[model samples]
Target: MIKKFLLTMCLLAALAVGGFLYVKQSVTDFIAQPLKIEQPHLVTVERGNNLNTIISKFVDDQWINPTQFSTLVRRFHPNLTQIKVGTFEVLPGMTFEQALNTIINGKEYQLAITFIEGSTFKEWREQFKQAEYLEHETDGLTEAEIARQLGIEHDKLEGLFLAETYHYSVGDSDLDILKRAHRKLDVILEQSWASRQDKLPLKNSYEALILASIIEKETSVPSERERVAAVFVNRLNKRMRLQTDPTVIYGMGDRYDGNIRKKDLREATPYNTYVIDGLPPTPIAMPGKASILAAMNPENSNYLYFVASGTGGHVFSKNLRDHNRAVQQYLRQLRSKK
Candidate 1:
């Protein structure tokens, strides 16, 4: 009877041990399994969000099982309070551990600022000011002062910053961002200048940039940049005025109330191409890579004049008579449409 009783006790103990082991294995598998998220998702933890709130978000987003997620968070990330708040890209099939580690490890969020070709400095400033992460304030610096801060000698920072989408950290300063952009522009310009076609009309790389700025302002169409550059190149070769309206607009400065009157065109300012010969004293606006390349290697043409075609592009001509005809055609089209 005593032997039978001991045997029964041993069997019961073995069964209990086996059941405990099975339960442990099940829990471990559940916790370790990768959570497969099908769609692209953004997880934003705003500043000062607590650990419970973050876990709730994960659970609600179907990113994790609540109990397993809570266990992992409590065990591994006891210091969940230290997680920085910002946006994070959540990839598919990432485990809770992996996501938690990513958020806690200070991975920077990249946001892009796209400066379109031919944008003025004023426009660029406004865009940067309006950016969510950037701090906006009254810039007490004059144009000259801003240039000085940027380490450029010219009063105009126009045509210096290359137009492209630049990535930045969450709270990068405006000055620092601009400086980095200028540095990038310098490197690209140097490379382009070195590989340029020889014996062009430009005196130097700066002169090339000036002409490129003109091309950028003249047309919004990518196909017309080279042609516009060609016209300006022909004029430069012949020592003729560029006669671009963009220059007149630049010369008007702050007083420019968005209208280019006949008198504005006729008025002689340093930047007025209609009134003065050769390149302007400074670039009117920033040029993009295409315009810069076009200026460097203009399409080989005898074109010396162009006028807006009222189709958001320009009509190029090789001589004065053809240019006048294009002007009349564009004017008539404009009047008829109005």
Candidate 2:
């Protein structure tokens, strides 16, 4: 009787092991099967989302059997408790294992934002605020507070970020993009300063940044950038006011009615180059690398004035009489347009 009982116990143990092996193979096969979706599907992994939630979504969509999928995940990625936050694209024919791997690695979507040259810091912030993919950590913070958080010591925050397209993942913060732009600006500034032409009227790299911002706002034409910088450099050398109209518009702030008149130039704001002796207290707009390079190495010319030449470019002049002629030509062109 004892021998019979022992033999029966061995048989039961063998059957249990066989059943476990069969279940394991079935789960593996389930994971290896093609997904149910006919087209590509977007899977958004929100921050702190549990693995079960992700699985449940797929299960609800009839993409996979929950029990089999859970068994497969346990057998394979047993330690994976959370998915990375981002927009992930799951292809129609991908196996469950491939989809899981894609989610875990966070390699789904690439997002980009551009900060345009000659745009103000305010505009850059507005763009950041409007971006849906980026996490807005700087939202509702004052300019000073935001600058402080980024460790930027500039009294005025305008033009601190570089003008370029920054790429990031979905879970990235606005501060991350800001830091990237700031670092890029810092790198470019140092290089420009190190290679700058000698005896420039500007005091330091910060002043170069200020001049670069002015140059960026002066003209959009690539050929005119150095000429514009040269005009400003000449004015600085001759102790003439760097009377650029963009400076007055910036100084006017909320009061500028899309026009500059005698009073705006006459107002003694720190940014009003018509009233101030030298560069503004801060950069007026974000400058690109070309503008910064142009500021550092202005063309050797006698040009001290520039006016819009009816076209998108400028008419540069060396003296008041020529500048006046250019201004008259600009008026004639405007009259013709009307």
Candidate 3:
């Protein structure tokens, strides 16, 4: 009877060990198995989202088993608080471990959008449509619509967004990109405006921006910007019409053909400096940092007019007579060289 009892105890011990090993194997397989998804998904963790919120999102999306997903996530990723707050793409066949790594390591796929300086609103809209984050073949939103969505007024948007590369996730709105660009511009402009010179002719920062835009369009040379600003300042002080060719181009509006004809000059328009005195109604284009600084602190000079020399630079003159003479010289030289 004692031998039989000992044998029964050994059999029970063996059964317990087998059960423990089976449970361990099942847990390992569950952790290793990929979660199959029928469609691609996106998850956004807001700036203040916590670990519980993120886990709940996974469960709600049916991407993980709610009962075991949290335990699995904690087991694989000890640093749950390190998960980045941003939009992430959730792909099919990704294990719980892989998803955790993707969020923690910032391995989320990004969509890139590039805005080139000097692009018009229409042009920017076209480029936005081609972005990977945006839906293709959809009727695109207008610039006004985008600005409205971003809580920016239409008039305040021109020349507001800076040119740079931007990143977003799939299905990001056009307004989202505009807002990002505008925010960057706002910070840069504020910093620049704070350091501006005192006693500038511009009534406000906007006027300074307008002058800078003119300087930007007038010349591409960094060294010439201050000189160009000086010319405009002299004209403004003397109460003479700016007569900037770019202003005339702006006056022609969307009707402006490829050429700047004599008729366009004679026609009266709000933006036509040839006809109207002082600055134009608005800026002609976005100015770079160099141009903005030049407008704020123009070089003091007697130069009242400037004409493009055949070279990349410009020829400045103190008076109309000198300007005419310089024009003749430059034009003759250009003809002779050709």
Candidate 4:
């Protein structure tokens, strides 16, 4: 009877070991199963989501079997159960274990949106409407209301945001990006103003922003920014009307059909520098760092006027006579091209 009891105990121990190995192998196989992915897509693991809930999402979506993949995380890979909150780019051919590891330890995918230099706030808003994975909370809000929310008392919002590439995750808002740009512009503008050259005609950082916006619209060549700034600065010191075409365009608003007419220039508008004596009511466009720096410290030159050279640069002049000649030259070049 004792010998019979010993044999029965050995049989029970063997069956237990066999059950443990079968479970371990099953978990390994399920973890190695290829994830179901037909096309690339974005997946967001929201806050307070656990591994079971996440796996259930896959199961509900028919991407995996509930019974085949559930026990693997808790029984074998306990670390994968500590899933993180992020947006991930799930691609084709990833295994179940790889996807979990990506959610747990891999870096979240980042998308970028760029605000081009010389763009207006309206243009930026239009871009916000079209951006993917970004929340549009500022839609339908007026500029004044938006400013109040951003803690700004400024009358207008143009040229407030810096022109640069900003990165964000799936859940970020347009206001979040705007706030960062505004803060950065504030810091940069303050630093530039504090170290500005003495005797500048600009009264404050706002005026610098206004001038910088014009400079940004005037030239795209990197080498021409300082010289272009000098012409505007010299005109400001001489009390000459800015007579800039961009200001006329801005004043016309939707009436501007990509062409500036003499009648449009003759019209008296607050933003039309040809009619106004000083900088416009606000900045007309977003200016970059170099343009801001140029506005703060212009090159020391006698230039008072400039005209586009048709070759992607400008012909600067110190007097009306030379400026008129350059204008005539530019007209001739246009005629020759035509």
Number of clashes in every candidate structure?
1, 0, 0, 0
Residue 15 alpha-carbon offset, candidate 3, angstroms: 8.0
Give the residue spans of candidate 4 off by over 4 A.
Answer: 1-4
Output the TM-score of candidate 2.
0.81
TM-score of each: 0.73, 0.81, 0.67, 0.96
lDDT of 1: 0.78
lDDT (10s digit) by residue, model 1, range 1-338: 99999999999999999976765665455446566688746667778786667777877867777663354445444655466688676677777656666677747566678888788888889888777566443267777888888889878788788778888766566777788778877887777788787778877888888888888888879999888888888888888888888899899989799899999998989999999989987778888888888888888889988898888888888888999999999989989998
lDDT of 4 by residue, 1-338 (tens): 99999999999999999987887877777777787879876768999998887888877776665565365668687877878899987677988788888888878988899999999999999999999999998999999989988998795899999999999999899999999999999988999999888999999999999999999999999999999999888889999989999999999998889999889889999899999998998999999999999999999999999999999999999899999999999999999998
Poorly placed runs, candidate 1 (over 4 Å): 1-99, 104-107, 135-138
What 10-residue stretch in candidate 1 is worst by lDDT? 68-77
| Whole-model lDDT per candidate | 0.78, 0.87, 0.74, 0.89
Candidate ranking under lDDT, highest first, comes to 4, 2, 1, 3
Residue 97, candidate 4: C-alpha displacement in angstroms? 1.0
lDDT of 3 by residue, 56-165 (tens): 77767667765543545455446755778777776788875567667777666787877755554556677876776575432565556656777776544556666678
lDDT of 2: 0.87
Q: Show the lowest summed lDDT stretch of 10 residues, model 4.
A: 64-73
TM-score order of candidates, top first: 4, 2, 1, 3
Candidate 2 lDDT tens digits, 200-251: 9988999999999999998999999998999999889999999888999999
Best by lDDT: 4
Better of 2 and 4 by TM-score: 4
